[model samples]
Target: MALHFSRDEFASRLELVKARMKEEKLDALLIFAQESMYWLTGYDTFGYCFFQCLVVKADGQMVLMTRSADLRQARHTSIIEDIRIWVDRTNADPAQDLKNLLMDLDLLGSKIGVEYDTHGLTGLNARRLDHQLTSFGTSTDASYIISKLRLVKSAAEIEYAEKAAALSDDALDAALRLAKPGANEADILAAMQGAIFAGGGDYPSNEFIIGSGADALLCRYKAGRRNLDAVDQLTLEWAGVYAHYHAPMMRTVIVGTPNDRQKELYAASRDAIEAIETVLITGNTFGTVFDTHARIMDERGLAKHRLNACGYSVGARFSPSWMEHQMFHAGNPEPILPGMTLFVHMIIMDSETGTAMTLGQTYLITDGPVKSLSRHSLDLISV
Candidate 1:
């Protein structure tokens, strides 16, 4: 099997997950989160856009219910041997298949925990499963049971994250080299993604957030692309993924001469990140860290240019977003801890001046201070 971790490690992860299941009084867990599946057994596949689930019994027995397309995928990538395939006929109901599987295991009447928030389980399918299981047993929303267990990184996980971070630095360097006057934004993005893949990295959970000129002020990825202006800022946010672990980086490059206002914004953005770093150590509240960023930007008179949240937890994630559930924002009382990966971005987009300046990097939280994952300098780049 192509399991990413050793058998012992996978076994330990299962033990942790099952322990959490017991704590929640969950007789069984219906894991629909792809990340949770991969973490438990190295079941890697993009087939999660369809219906699939990994059922873990309280006794620690696990089974994967998926489509035929992912049959070989499960065999090769994961240690899951007892795989069940659900047919794709128009009238076929996989929920019924799941119910049968539960009955076969003599768990049909037991309380089960379902991952209601994952993309792997659609609303229609969830309702169907809930309706069917209502007669058999109770299914509770227990997404956080497995998710919270994954917040802290193991040693092997951190190693993969470190490699991803270095490759992300390489990607940023390649993209920066291509950020010249009259350069195509598409080419820059290609260079960035290509660098990561060339370095033995996997595709990130989401598309790169890249834009130039007026579009640079935006944060999320969009449909159209543009060329770098001779005197404009090119904003980029990309990640290097390895073994599904992500190390994301963000920076804004000036194609030509930067105005005084742009430079001032960049300085404040850098200072804001530095201030946040001071409070990102272990034992600090995540909100405290965000407050540092907010205070820096607000005190610098750039509050209007800031984003609502400063950063979030990062880990092995699949598309839609690389952001983990734990976020650093106002009123979020989540505490920072060692072995956590976080990405903090000092995003400042001044719509009034039509300029953008953003600086971001990922870090591994240690006992004392956090270690920078991205190798690139946090200073604003000009080319």
Candidate 2:
């Protein structure tokens, strides 16, 4: 098997899940999150876009129900021994197939937990699952069980996270070399991604955010590309992925001489992020971090330009997004724990002045102090 984690590590993870399941009175878990399945059984695939479920019984028994295309994929990449294939055809009901699997496992009348909040489980499929399970078993939305467990990184996961961080720094180095005036956005993006790949990194969970000129104010990835102006700004947000562990970084580079507004924004961003660093500790909650960012930005009179959310937890994830469930937003009660990898960002976009400034980096939360993953300095880049 092409398992990234040791069998013992996988076993430990499974035990943790079972413990949580027991605590929640869940007799079985219909895990639909790809990240959950991969963490539990070393099953890795993008096939989760379709209907697929990993059924885990409280007794430590596990079964996977997926399409035929992933039969060998599971065999090769996962530790799952009991794999069941659901035929894919016109009007095929994989939910029914899942129900059959549950019946076979004698879980028909059991209290099951379903991981419904994920990209892996589409709304249509979720409705199908609920419909199929009606009167068969009691189901509860326990989506956060595995996610909460995954918030703290294990030693092996931390190793991968550190490697990802190194690759992130490398990508920034490559991007900075080509971010000068007249540089093509596409070329800069290619160089950045290339650096990660060259450093033995894996493909990120989502597309890198790359925009220049007026589009620099955009935080999301868009379709087109353009060359850098003689005096322009480039906003980049990218993650270096290694073994599915992510270390993300963001920056809004000033292509030429930065204007007064840009400088002020950058300074505010830097100050806010630094303030956040002091609170990203074991005692502080995710909400506290955001409050610190908001306070600094609002005090600097840039509240309108600041984003509501500061950042989020980063970890092994699938396509569609890299952000974990825990985020730095107002009033979030999620505690900041040791061994958690978090990306803290300060994004300030001023549309009126047509200026953008963003600064972000991933950190490993420890008992003593948070450790920066990226080796790159936080100083504003002007190329």
Candidate 3:
């Protein structure tokens, strides 16, 4: 089936944000950047360029602020009711222009919060924004506010993500079917990507690396002129967005019967992933999961090569980002509440052997148990 999401799903998420805003003592949440804008509004007019900003206040009023040129398309597509369009000047900074529009809309001094993301705001842009905010006396900084709201999963979002993971599994199915001793890694990539479009999926956030043999030395590495060998181990690390949510994961593939050494390591990784999956129930601290995996690897003396965590974030988008959750994650200890979903991938890269291994799965946090959404088998496959 073609992949898509219901508009009600996004609407429900916005309401979730509204509830978060009330708890956070926020009047409205100001949104910039592409991902959050799409997550809240359901309109994705390629916000990668040009002016696209939004203000969602608590009065059930969500206003989208954009330039005059973008207003027509935005109103035609955005879920927001109020469309505030600003006229562009011949020679002016868009940031300053946005500030002026905010002041005109009386949003100044409204405890507005901005997302600086990983990088701190710079001096020039900060000075310009400060000068503009001073004109109307508004307060602003990186609140890490939107993140907490984004952590918990909404029902409709899980539904779409579940489907997205299935679509990705199908993509890998097609890729593995095409894998052969004579084919290059790119050969299977083309086949996998073709299946993605055939199933109505869009582009992956990062490149999908499907290399084998020498190419597998570096983790998150790429496929080169190196050809797949019948005896060589294969790795497939890929995740893409469906309806703007992240469905990140990976899988291991072998072209034919595996040798003794390869088979042993593969069994260890596969078993380790299974052990983690079995215990990934709701309310368990993520550290508990990591410590357990670390112990398993410690028993094998493979702890140093094991990653920090067994899983990471899965949402309406596949991020090319560094994970920094304040709770229930590494460096931060908080309970794993129900309504959060994540994709767990265990990767082992051996540069000396020119080999790599991966075992991945996706799960949703529920009151009773963690429901596994990825139905793909976790065994060594002979393609």
Error of 1 at 362 (Å): 0.4
Q: Which stretches of candidate 2 lie over 4 Å from their true place?
A: none
CA lDDT scores, all candidates in order: 0.89, 0.93, 0.65
For all predicted structures, in order, the TM-scores are 0.97, 0.99, 0.85
Per-residue CA lDDT of candidate 3, range 230-275, in tens? 7776778766456666566677677677766567667768777777
Model 3: residues with Cα > 4 Å off, grouped in runs: 1-12, 49-51, 58-60, 67-73, 84-91, 118-131, 134-143, 221-225, 318-329
In model 2, what are the clashing residue pairs, if there are any? Answer: none
- The positional error of residue 310 in candidate 3, measured at the CA in angstroms, is 3.0
**Per-residue lDDT value at 250 in model 3:** 79
> Model 2: per-residue lDDT, tens digit, 198-257?
999999999999999889999999999999989989999999999999999999998878
Residue clash pairs of candidate 3: 109-138, 153-339, 244-316, 244-317, 245-315, 245-316, 245-317, 246-315, 246-317, 328-334
**For candidate 1, lDDT tens digit of each residue in 178-278?**
88888898898899999999999999999999988889999999989887777888888999999989998898888888889889998898888888888
Evaluated with TM-score, which candidate comes out highest? 2
| C-alpha positional error of residue 170 in candidate 2 after TM-score superposition, expressed in Å | 0.7
TM-score of candidate 3 to 2 decimals: 0.85
| Model 2 per-residue lDDT at 106 | 95
Once all C-alphas are superposed, what RMSD does model 1 give against the true structure? 1.2
- Which prediction has more favorable lDDT, 1 or 2? 2
Q: Candidate 1 at 84: error in angstroms?
A: 0.6
lDDT, candidate 3, at 52 = 50
